[model samples]
Target: MRTLILTALLATTTALAATAQDASNTLDRGNWQDAASLGASLDSADGYTIAAKATTLGASVSPDSAKAALLKKAQSYANQAIKLNPNSASAYFELARADGRLAQYTGILESLGLAGEIKKALVKAIDLDPKFDEAYVALGLWNAELAAKGGGASFITGARGDQVIPNFEKAIAIAPTTIAHRLEYANSLLLLNRNSNRSAAIAQLQKAVSLTPVTYWDKQDLAAAQKKLDALR
Candidate 1:
C-alpha cells in the first residue's frame, strides 16, 4: 500500500510539473491567451499566478476597449492564487498590476478606491519577497500618478511625491538590465516632476533604449523608450 501511495504521489507531481512546463512554453512562444488558458486549468497556486501574469501581459497589448476585461480576468486569477497560497509574492504583485491597469479606465473616486487596494497588494508582495523589483516599479508609479494629479488626489491616496524616484531607483538597482524597469522609471520621473527630473529621466530612457530586448513586450518598451528619449532630446 505504501508503494502504491508513493507511486500515485509521484505521478501527481509529474503531472503538475508537466502542466507548468507547458504553460511556460506557451508563454515563451508569445501565445498569451493559450498560456493563460492552460494556467487556469491547472490546480495549483503557481498555475493561477501564471494565468494572472499572462492575462495582464495580454491586456497591455490589447485594445483600450478590451483592456478592462482582460485586467478583470487577471484580477480574478490573482485572487485565486492568493486564496490558494497566501504567501505567493508574485500572486500579490499580479493582483496589484491588474488593479493599477483597471484604474486607468475608472472615474477619479473609483481609481482612488483601487489605489488603496493596489498599495496594499504591492506592500504585501514586497513583504513576502523583498527582491520583487516589479512591485517597486508599480509602487513608484502609484506615487507619481497620484502626486501628478495634485489637488486632493495625492492627499486622499496618501501618495507622497518624495517616494516616487526612490522606489524607481530601488527597482533599477535590483534589475539594472531590465528594459521595462528603466523605461517605467524614466516615465514616472517625467510624470512626477518633468522639469526637475528631465536630465535623470533622459538618462534612464537612453539606457532603456540601449538595452537588448528579449521578448515582444521588451521590444515594445524599448521602442517607447527610444521615442521618449528622442522627444526629450
Candidate 2:
C-alpha cells in the first residue's frame, strides 16, 4: 500500500509538473488571476487547485519559507474542503499531513494546535475511510509523540505506546512500500527503546535504513541510527 501511495505520488507529481508547465506556456495575466480567484472559492472544484498549489509550493520552496506558506494555504483549503464535503476524508488527511509537517518544522509544543487538528481530522478520516493507510500512519505518529511528551490527559498518558505501535504496524501491513511510513514507525520504536526495547529498536532502525532509498535525509537518518546502535553496543 505504501508502495502504491509512493507510486501515485510520483505519478501525480510528474503529471502536475507537466500540467503546470503547459499552463505556463499559454498563461496570460488574466488567465492566471482567473485561475487563482477560482481556486480561492470554497468548493470541490477549487479544493484540488488549492491543494495542488500548496503541494507544488511545498515541494519547491525552502523548508523555512515554503513550509510556512504551504501550511497556511493548506489549512485554509482543508477547512473549505471539509465544509464543502464533510465526508471527504482525503481532505482531512491532507490537512493532517500539512499540520504534521508544521509540527515537525516548528516544535510540537509550538504547533500543538495544528497537531491536535490533525489528530481530530485523522479520527474523522478513519471513521469515514477505514482503509486509509496514511491517516492511520499519521495518527500513530501523533499518538506516539503526544504520549511520549506526556500530553493527552491522564487516562491516555503513556498507554499510547501500546496504541501507537499497533497503528503503525497496521499502516505498514497495509502499505509496505512506503519508506517514510516505516521510518516513522521505526522512530516510534526508537522512542520506545529509550525505555524497554533497545535491541528491538536497533533492529527496526537497521531495517528502516536498509529499506530506504538513497536520499540525503535517508542517508543522514541511517548514519544517525548507526551511531545510536554503536552507542548501544
Candidate 3:
C-alpha cells in the first residue's frame, strides 16, 4: 500500500511539472495569438499572464472604437491570471491598466472610480514586488492627473500632487532606458501645464525621443514624443 501511494504521488508530481514546462514553452512564443491559445487552454497561471500581455498590446494600439474590446480581453486574461495565482503582481498591474484605459473611454464619474481602482492595484503590485517600476509610472500619472484637475477634483479623487514627481523619479531611477516610463513621466509633467514645468517635460520627452525603439508601442510613443517636443518648441 505504501509503495502504491508513493508511485501515485510521483506520477502526479511529474505530470504537473510537465504541464508547467509546456505552459512556459507556449508563453515564450513571440506572437500574441500563440500566447492566447495556450493561456486560454484550461486553468493556468502562465497562460493567463501571457494572454493578458497580448490583450494589453492590443489595447495600447487599438483605436477608441476598438479599444473597449481589447481592454475587455485584457481584463479577462488578467482576472484569470489573478484567479490562478492570487499573488501575481504583474497580473494585478495589467488589470489596473485595463481599468484605467476603460475609464478614459467612459464618463468622468466612472473614470474617477476607475482611478481609485488604479491606485489600489498599483499599491498592491508594489507591495508584492518592490521593484515594480512600471506600477510607479501609473501611480505617478494618477497623482499628476488629479492634481491638474484642481481642488474639487483632488478632493473627489484623493490624489496628491506631492507624490507625483517622486514616484516618476523613482521609476526612472529604477529603469532609466524604459521608453514608456520616460514618456509617462513627461506626460505627467506636461499635465501640470505650468510654464515652469513645461521645460522639464520637454527635457524628459527629448530623452525618450532619442532612445531606440525596443517594442511596437515604443515606436508609436516615440513618434508622439517627437510631435510633442515639436509643439513645445
Candidate 4:
C-alpha cells in the first residue's frame, strides 16, 4: 500500500511538471489562450504567474477594443498568483504591467490613480528580486509617462524625470541583449524629452534592432525599434 501511494505521488508530480512545460512551450509559441488555460488549470503560484504573463501578452496583441478586457484578466491572474505566493516577484511584475497597460485606456484621473499602484507593484517586484531587469524597465516607463503628463501629474505622483534614464540603464546593464529593454529605453527617452535625447534615443533603438528576438513581444518591439530608427535617421 505504501509503495503504491508513493508511485502515484511520483506520477502526479511528473504529470504536473509536464503540464507546466507544455504551458511554457505554448507561451513561447505565442498561443496565449492555450498557455493561459494550461497555467490556470495547474492551480499553483507559478502556474498563475504564467497565466498572468499569457494574458498580458494577449492584451498586447489584441485589438484596442479587446485590450482593456484582457489586461484586466491579466491583473486578476497576477493577483491570484500573489495570493498563493506573496513573495512572487513575477506576479507583482505582471500585475504592474497589466495595471500600467490598462491605464492607457482609462480616463485621465483614473489613469493617474493607477500610476501609484503600478509603481508600488514594480517597486515590490524589484525589492523581491534585485536582478529583475524588466521591473527596472517598467519603472523607467512609469517615470517617463508621468513626466510626459507634465507638472500637475508629476507633482501629484512624485515622479522625477531624472529617474527614467537611470532605471532603463540599470535594466540594460543587467540584461544588455534584451530587445525590449533597449527599445523601451529608447522609447522613454523620446517620450520624456525627444529634442534633447533624440541622438541617444536613436542609438538605443539601433541597438534594439540589432538584437535577436526571443519572444513575441521582443519581435514586436524589435520591428518597431527598426521603424523608429529609420524614421529618426
The number of the candidate with the highest lDDT is 4
Residue 1 CA error for candidate 4 (Å)?
Answer: 4.7
lDDT of 2 by residue, 186-216 (tens): 6776665575766666666666656655443
lDDT of 1: 0.92
lDDT scores of the candidates, listed in order: 0.92, 0.63, 0.80, 0.93
lDDT of 3 by residue, 152-230 (tens): 7789879988888999988989988888888888889878775878889889998999898765566777888888889
Model 3 segments more than 4 A misplaced: 1-34
**Candidate 4 lDDT for residue 219:** 82
Give the C-alpha miss distance for residue 11 in model 1, angstroms: 3.7
Spell out the clash pairs found in candidate 3. Answer: none
Looking at candidate 1, what is the lDDT of residue 36?
Answer: 97
Q: Give per-candidate clash totals.
A: 0, 3, 0, 0
How much is 190 displaced in model 3, in angstroms? 0.8
lDDT of 4 by residue, 98-119 (tens): 9999999999999999999999
Give per-residue lDDT, candidate 1, residue 73.
Answer: 96
> CA lDDT of 189 in candidate 3?
84
